[model samples]
Target: MKLKNNVLVTADWLKSHLNEPFVKVVDATYFMPGTPRDALSEWKGKRIPSAEFFDYDTRICDKPSSLPHMLPSADTFSKEVGLLGIRNEDTVIVYDTAGIFSSPRVWWMFKVMGHENVFVLDGGLPAWEHANGEIDTSEPTRVEPTNYQATFDQTRVIDKSQLLEGINNGTVNVIDVRPNERFLGLVPEPREGVRSGHMPNAVNLPFAQLLEAGKFKSAETLKMLIESALSDSKRNVASCGSGVTACILAIAAEYASGDVVTVYDGSWTEWGSDHELPIVSGK
Candidate 1:
């Protein structure tokens, strides 16, 4: 299906353009708290040909923040991306091992940093395998770093204070992408000290609902699901347990409805941890 914003690129497309110098593939695999897999180790074992590992968890984040993988400053983003051999003119394709999981987070990160030519791999690594794409097991070759410049777009992100203000004023529609159980506070949060409920007035639209067999559903279906949850609101904000899965919602919304959905970078990790922030349980 053709998306309005072209946010996704198929495995076949990557395979055909694999040799192009301007097309850079990235392995953005990230496992949550209890997951046993180590992203860096897996990348070293096998990955798409010429794909580099984008370590959002450690290397490319706001290291000062206690929260998980918070957005790094524009200077940090620029330097890290430049080290990945990416230039401003390159077309980046991001993917993850678990089909459509953490890849969109990197994709959204690039967008927030004002890089418009980035796309997430549709169905991720599993899709590439399905398409009979060649995999490289040899150690990655280091490419010469480029002078990548990132222009941060402030409107693409929101903090807890700004989100609260917008919610209070009835100007923003907050879409919480956590599981229904977590959104309702029926299950304990994976992170220590974080609460299990959602933000006040936040609508829960689990990220899984937007995917079918590891790939996004048709644009028509995505539009339907998002609109049903959002109702009539236009100013959208996406949030999840940490900051990662919220990006899946944001990128999918952009694909479905040609408008940008701002991500709450700290998400529940920041909101639920602080007692001052109001959280509501039970839908």
Candidate 2:
């Protein structure tokens, strides 16, 4: 489960390595509610040659959860990924239609499942098309399922109870990657019924501040920016609307050489909606 030194790959690098036997490309596009786009249909229409569609919403989540797209059981994840023709040793490259959006979640998911060779496509599919890389509408090749089993990395993810305990004991810092307005409670949450503020004592990073047109800042720049917010404390739990954008912070933190980083799997959607949870406004 050891990861590469770098978790990002440029479009040029991926295009050149398309023919590598161990590579598996994944389209991990996901849109929030009220954003009108059918991810599955779009992938079926056109995608990077040899890329498979990872339906983050449907085929690979905790189906019984009232919350959106929570993590599935390790066995469930292993089986679904196995059905996608993924093997434990394969190198995974995940991208979303929106540059860098939602792709990091899949990358994080892979890492949590103990597959660390995965990388996010820098600037995502748009970067590939801009680079004039190959695009295909050909039917995806179906492959026989592989025997896949996942070893969950407990240190990479945190549940609601752990988050509450950490917050209460002041043993961990929480970072919310939501936009400034949402983090400050100036705007309503995109998900209806959810409150508009951040967790008590959580700091705001606004996920976008670490990117430029969907590409990440250099590791040095990222480290400096994060350090400016964190000062000296490094132990952190990341969260956002649902659980997706939280991983963006986790990935950025790792690239910045920060430690004690883990994602809150049920993020703001779960926290904000619970009236009993202590939430504060106006950072």
Please give the CA lDDT of all the candidate structures: 0.91, 0.88
The count of backbone overlaps in candidate 1 is 0
lDDT of 1 at 171: 88
**lDDT score, candidate 2:** 0.88
The reply for model 1, stretches above 4 Å from the true place, is 1-5, 231-234
Q: For model 2, what is the alpha-carbon lDDT of residue 67?
A: 91
**Which lDDT value does model 2 have at 119?**
89
Error of 1 at 202 (Å): 0.9
lDDT per residue (tens digit) for residues 27-143 in model 2: 999988877889988998889998888987887999999999999999999999999888999989999999988999999999999996898998998999999999998777787
Stretches of candidate 2 exceeding 4 Å from the true structure:
1-4, 231-234, 258-260
**The best candidate in terms of lDDT:** 1
Question: Could you tally the backbone clashes for each prediction?
Answer: 0, 0
Writing each residue's lDDT as its tens digit, candidate 1 over 1-283 gives 1233479999988898889878999999999878888999999999998899999999999999999999999999999999999999899999999999999999999999999889999999999999999999998789889899999999889998899999889889999999999999999998999987988888989999999999999888999998876645557899998989999888888889876889999999999999988889898
Candidate 2 has which clashing residue pairs, if any? none
TM-score of 2: 0.95
Per-model TM-score on C-alpha atoms:
0.96, 0.95
Q: Residue 45 CA error for candidate 2 (Å)?
A: 1.1
